[model samples]
Target: MKSSFTFVCCMILFSALIKSQTSLYMPLDIKKAYANGTRNYDGTPGKNYWQNSADYKISAQIFPKEKLLKGSETITYFNNSPDTLNYLVFRLYQNIYQFGAPREFGINKKDLHDGIKIHRIKLNEAEF
Candidate 1:
């Protein structure tokens, strides 16, 4: 009985694997990564795979009674790729509430305000 049950389970799993492989799709960029030896055909990281990393030091203060919050962050990013980077893109999710900003969900009138205020930004000890 145990052997029969195990065989049935294995058959089901094998069928599922075959079905999934038939529907597998690889985007152009992912295909490029495979060609570049950054990823293997078996969906594993290849020996040449590399990923960028960053370390952040952040400080914040909250004024509970005034319902205000302030924060600052210092990020040290390391570029592990062979190519030199000209610029970096950062996402500010809260900016979705900013005036004239596009949003998928509706926002209450009273809840809407200036999304984020950037006090200062310095890179490599030089202000931009």
Candidate 2:
């Protein structure tokens, strides 16, 4: 099942890439780095550049009868950047639905039931 989903997603992405041929906009510093030979001019890569990605295991279930959707994920992040880590940032968008979270507009009162609950957060198997 996962293989089929991955195949469909890959096909869609390939089609979009072929059709759009999107180009990334590099900043002035990145262009300068390329000019100085620290990075490749044609987007090959950079010498001091770094990137990071993590494999995630996510499972979600939907209940049409209850009108609810629940999901959980385990993400093991790989910090391959050539920089020291201070802290990780997490955004809770559901806080926009909080009763009085300094919103630009208003939200439904009934929707203020425990916005974005994080049962546990662990780094290196040690809770922070």
Which regions of candidate 1 are displaced past 4 Å? 1-35, 40-44, 99-105
lDDT of each: 0.87, 0.79
Quantify how close model 2 is to the true structure by its C-alpha RMSD in Å. Answer: 20.1
* Best of the candidates, TM-score: 1
lDDT of 2 by residue, 54-94 (tens): 89999999986765668888998899876888988889987
Residue 16 error, candidate 1, Å:
24
Best by lDDT: 1
Q: Encode model 1's per-residue lDDT on 1-128: one tens digit a residue.
A: 99999999999999998878565687999999888898998899988899999999999999977767789899999999989999988888878878778888898876676778887878789897
Model 1 local distance difference test score:
0.87
